[model samples]
Target chain A: MKTLVVDYQAGNLRSVETALRHIGASHEITDDPVRLARAERIIFPGVGDAAHAMRLLAERGIDRVMRERHAAGIPILGICLGCQIVLEATEEGGAACLGLVPGTARRFPSECGKVPHMGWNTVRSREDHWLFRGVPAESSFYFVHSYYPAPESEEDAIAWCDYGIEFAAAVERGSLVATQFHPEKSGEAGLQLLRTFVEAG
Target chain B: MLQKRVIVCLDVRDGKTTKGVRFEGNVDIGDPVEMARACYEQGVDELVFYDITASAEGRGIMIEVVRRVAEQIFIPFCVGGGIATTDDMRAVLLAGAEKVSVNSQAVRNPRIIREGARRFGNQAIVLGMDALADRRMPSGYRVVINGGRVQTDLDALEWAREAERLGAGEIVVNSIDADGTRDGYELEVTRVIATGVGVPVVASGGAGVPGHLVEVFTRGAADAALVASMVHYGEYTVDDIKKVVADAGIPVRRQGARPEAGPV
Candidate 1:
């Protein structure tokens, strides 16, 4: 029942720590590849530059460990920038990512209202999965992203959130799940989403 | 659907929650941490803990207060009022606050906005502008600092545009004329700034009722409305204000925000 939140200098580490504690889920924030590999649950919590994060993941060999875990079919979640890097590549920094999921990260159009679609927006997901559990269909979550993942297959998008254009708010296939919004900052319902992820296989 | 937001602002001076009329004489209100937790229970979307005393005294933001509030409240909040540099912004965000607002210091050095936005994401940096109605200014509004005691040459509209260019995720367009007046927001200036910038704009300074929120959200083109005096004085509870806003056709995160979780 070990949960390891992979920390690649993510700024929201404490916030995630607070939420996991709220749901009574004991977890550890680690970058050690061995520790990350052995953890029963993995969450890639991120904020800040994607390229810098990718570089650190490579430098620390966390990317290799993540790939290994994903291949093993372990439950993994990526939040915000953490979610972006899970894809194959990102327009941000033109950086290559782990390729855990089948997608690429692209910037939201500048003319599409705001460059950074920063605020609370709804996620519409019809997919039946343990990730959402009791979460409402169109629940609003706090998002602060200039870029979002465009999954290769439309069915991979568990939830779609519209800003300038509808983008993958949550993408899932098999055991891999990631959200473009911060569950830790998204109030009570968000905490429940985190709890479901932690408790479910 | 992207819903409009209602943010509760707690003006803290010397570690005590305080409120003043038009940024003048102040009176102690209550413990900020306790008050913020209570408001969180009432379904306020977010809270902004402002370091009024520190900002006015030429000191740094009160990080201690931010940590206290962050520890108690689960929802996101912003720490503002004395943030002077990128390091200050980092300290605030690292202290568990989701956003850091820059006001007087931003006017002094506009580069702080760009640097802070570069270091932290733009979403973490907030630009707080105290505006006064001025016929001579291009936008018919001038930027003020130091609790509205000093007015800058920058126009509200122009500065907002510049802030957006420099990577400010949101702007707080506070009207000096309307602040603490209990009339309403200075809609003229608010509209100019909101429509002027592509980023989200927060209508601040004079929120007296829930309808004022609707006025700002619609006519003012604001993404969020900042409320202080109205909530601080107990004229309206957060739930009461939210019900009014929801009743007015504005969507809010009213469900599952209660301390004890249940169906909405």
Candidate 2:
């Protein structure tokens, strides 16, 4: 399956691209909206301010194509800031997002340990989902983020991790799957996730 | 829940693994790829490779080493030293490093931290601060750079706050005075920065025994601990340290038989 990793002048595209290559998945790293519209799976991987990332996506007209792809039932995966951009809006810059997922991205509560919960965290499965196909319930995944998405439906959340409080780690709705952690960097368990996503297609 | 991390730091010089006292008097240890694969089989939580020669050589050799290690090890690994620009970070990540640590460069160009975190995501950017306890300094600790050879007037706590503000996802506070001492972690210095910064802090240097790891986690307020000399010279295994931490009531990733509880 061909995977398209969207590049919006933000995020670790090379790492994600290298990871795909590691798994032997044919893929392309592109910022062009036309190319993104043709991939079997679209990955919106980003790192940076949510508002600025959204603006860049809009600038390149890739945002509309992404929404259309989602509507067409193409699987989409967002990591960190990419996950936040899928929300209805973000508190980072009070910017509008894709609204594919009914939620709002806000800075993690200050009292909850720290702003960015860095390092490896054990994710507990909320429900059986394809993303967690070979992943164990006690498996640890690398996480680095300062903000989190508060999804409207708890059912949409497939996995959760706790810092100072329990928060969604992986969210899925049909063909759309998003995780705050970088699967490309999460080790074997992470690679298994990508493999599962590829097989799901 | 966050699992207690067991990190093995590989200090590379001239494309080979090396370690020294207070970042001085380096000695060739072994090959980076050999050491990294060994640590991976031991089930280490993460691997940190620092190019000790980068700042002086103005280039990085760990990129190829990282690529080779990543091919063998499926766990998360971080690469540090001489990361001055986003392009530098991109090159390392493309070569297979999960995270890129910036120390001297971030201190010199604070915007590099912002750009790296912005472009690669905060998780990919780790700020490494080599701090020395200076009684004469106003903040009690001073930030040191260039492998702890150059001392800056900037306060350690102040730099940590700035790193977080600029989008650093984590801070690795290395105590220059206690490095390779085998005494214990500099709790006082680590606590001040940990409490000051809003991101997770990993305490480096001065870990001699299993008890020291406990002290770092409980007393130092450190989320994780980075060890070198102790693990390198076979003082303690990664599993042994995790067992000690777990036996002491701290949560650690357990892989084998737990060790007897040690005195905290």
Candidate 3:
């Protein structure tokens, strides 16, 4: 499958690129909006700040291209910070994001133990989504984030992971699937999730 | 319910993984890529790669290693070393590192922490502080940097608060006194930082037994526990540590395809 790994200066692009290669998928890592626009599937893997990342996207004009890709029915997967940027806005830096998914990204309550809920977390699948094919319910995926997207609809959530409180760990609406955990770093279970995404494409 | 985390740390120098005792007597373990893959097969919850040679070399090679390991394994990996600027953090992240850890650099330039968190989001930035117990200090622990080679006047608690304020998502408190001692974690120091910071605290150093992890979680109030020597030498498996934590009534995510029987 042809996949475009977004390069917005905020993603773990090489790692995401390497993971896609390991999964035997043909992928290109590019900051060029034109290349991204032509891909059959897109993967947005972000690791830096939402505001700065969004600013970089805006500078490159990739944000508009991403909105176009999402509207075109192309399967897109956002990992970690990438998932947060897909929301309407984030409290992290009051950054605006592509409102492809109806949600607002907010910091995990400080009372909820720690700020960034790092390490492995169990995600309970809320619905039958193709991205979760071959993955069992309550499968643990590696997560490293302090902010989680609070989707407007519970039906949009495909999986949930509990930190201080339960929050959306994975979201799916139409052809768009995004995860707060790094599928590239979630071990075999994560590989299954990526394989499902590639197959769906 | 939050599951207890089992972390395996790899100290990398010149592209090889090494482990030492009391921060001395360094010995080469093996290839970092191979060791990391093995840890993944053993179901390690997270992996930490500390570039012990970063500051001295004035550059970071762990990024390439992170790329290699990311290609081979599907597990969260944290990279720490000579990360001093936004460009450095961006380089590592672009190389495939899930989290970039800042230590001496964060101390020297607190803005680096703020800028990193602002650009990468707080979750992708990790502040690694190596602390040493000092009775005369206000917080009773002092922050050490440059791979524990230099001591700073900053108190552990104060530095932790500043790190969190600057948008550090996680804080890994490494006790230089207990590092590689294998007696246990420095609960006193870890507790002070964990209680002071709003971010997740990862207690590193002095992890000799499985129960030490429990002590870190309960007494230290740390969200995750990190170990290197014990797991690297095969003294204890990640699964063993999880069982010990689970048996202690603390929740831990168990390996395999089965779902967690209880509410997560």
Candidate 4:
């Protein structure tokens, strides 16, 4: 399958590209809306602030292309800030985001051990979703974010993890699948997740 | 629950991994790219490359090593040493590193932390500190720079808190006294800073055995432990240390381990 990694000039695009290359997936890295619209599968990977990323996406007109692709049922996987902006909005800069999922991203409180939650943590899948294929149970995925997505409905959340509070680690709605943790950086289990994203879908 | 991280540090000088005693008496070891791949395959949670080289040409070589490592290793890794400006951080990240660590340069000018955080986001910035135990300081520890050659008036804990407020996402505490000793971590200093700061604290130096890691996590309260001599010399593997940590009832991300953690 041809995979397109959406670049908004935020996040570790190189890591994502490297992971895809390691998985033997045919992929291209681009911010061009035309190329983004042509990919069979889309990997929306991001880091940094949501407001600035939204501005860059708007400037490139990739936001419209993403929404149209989602409507047409093309699979899109979001990571970190890429996952956060998929919600209706994010508390970071109080910026509006793509309304692909019904929710908002909120920052972790000071009481949650640490704010950024940087390290490895276990993610428990809620169901037998294809995204968890070949992924062992209670596998640890690398996380480095202060804010996490709180989806509006419980049904949309496919996985949950606890730092200070139980928050949505992964969520899915039709062709959309997003993870607050970095699968590309999560090692073997994470590599399995990317493989499932390419083969099963 | 977040598993305590086991990070293998590769001190690079002239594109080759090196080791020293208390940050002195350095000697070349092996290729950094090859060593990084081996550690990744061994299931190390993370990797940190500290460019100990002090020349402009070495910086270019460090970037090249980072690119090659990024292509092979799938886990998260950080690059540090001689990174003085935002441009330096950008160059490293663009070459394919997950995070850029600022050490002695961050002490010389703390604003680089905020500036780099602003341009690249706080999550991309790490504060690497080499602190020594000093009874005269308020926190009982003094900050040192230039690979433990210069001592500063800044308290170690104070510097850590300030760096966090300035937008450093994480703090790495290296004990100048305990480094390269192969003894154990400085539990007092590591504990003090780990509780004082709200960000994740990494304990470095003096890890001779797996039990030292368990001590750092359970007693010192460090979120991660950075190992060099113990693993670099082939005395212990990353999995060996992790197995001991897990056997102690501490949670760790063992590659393809049993699926004991079911649905929440």
The top-ranked prediction according to lDDT is 4
Compose the digit string of candidate 1's lDDT tens values, residues A28-89: 98889989978778989898888999999999999999898888899998899988999999
Docking class for model 1 is medium
Superposed by TM-score, candidate 1 places the C-alpha of residue A167 at a distance from the truth, in angstroms, of 2.1
All models: lDDT?
0.84, 0.81, 0.82, 0.89
Specify the highest-TM-score model's number.
4
Which stretches of model 2 miss by more than 4 angstroms?
B21-25, B54-60, B70-76, B84-90, B104-125, B165-167, B233-235, B254-264
Question: Per-candidate interface C-alpha RMSD?
Answer: 1.7, 3.5, 2.6, 1.9
Choose 1 or 2, whichever is better by lDDT. Answer: 1
The Cα error of candidate 4 at residue A156, in Å, is 0.9
Candidate 1 error regions (>4 Å)? B21-24, B55-61, B259-264
Ranking by lDDT: 4, 1, 3, 2
The window of 10 residues in a row where model 1 chain B has the poorest summed lDDT is B255-264
**Tens-digit lDDT track for model 4 on B1-264?**
999999999999989998775446888889999888778877888899999998999999999999999888888899998899999999999888988999989988999999999998888899999999999999999999998999999999999999999999889999999987879999999999999998889999999999999999999999999998788877887888888999999988787322222110
Q: List the residue pairs that clash in candidate 2.
A: none
Model 1: per-residue Cα lDDT over B1-264, one tens digit each: 677888999988887888774456888888888788878877778899888774433333367777777776777799887778787788878888989999989999999999988888788889999999989998899999997999789988999888888988899998989987778888888888888888889999778888898888888888888998787767777878778888989877675366332111
Could you arrange the candidates by DockQ from highest to lowest? Answer: 4, 1, 3, 2
Tens-place lDDT per residue, model 2, B111-193, is: 99999876777777899999999988777999999878999989999999899889888899999999878799999898998
TM-score of each: 0.94, 0.88, 0.87, 0.95
lDDT of 3 by residue, B1-264 (tens): 666677889989878898665556778878899888777766777788888774544244566787788778766678888888888888777777778999998998999999988777777789999999999889999999876899999988988998988888888999999986889999999899888777788999999999999999999988889988777777766776777888999877777322222211
State the TM-score for model 2: 0.88
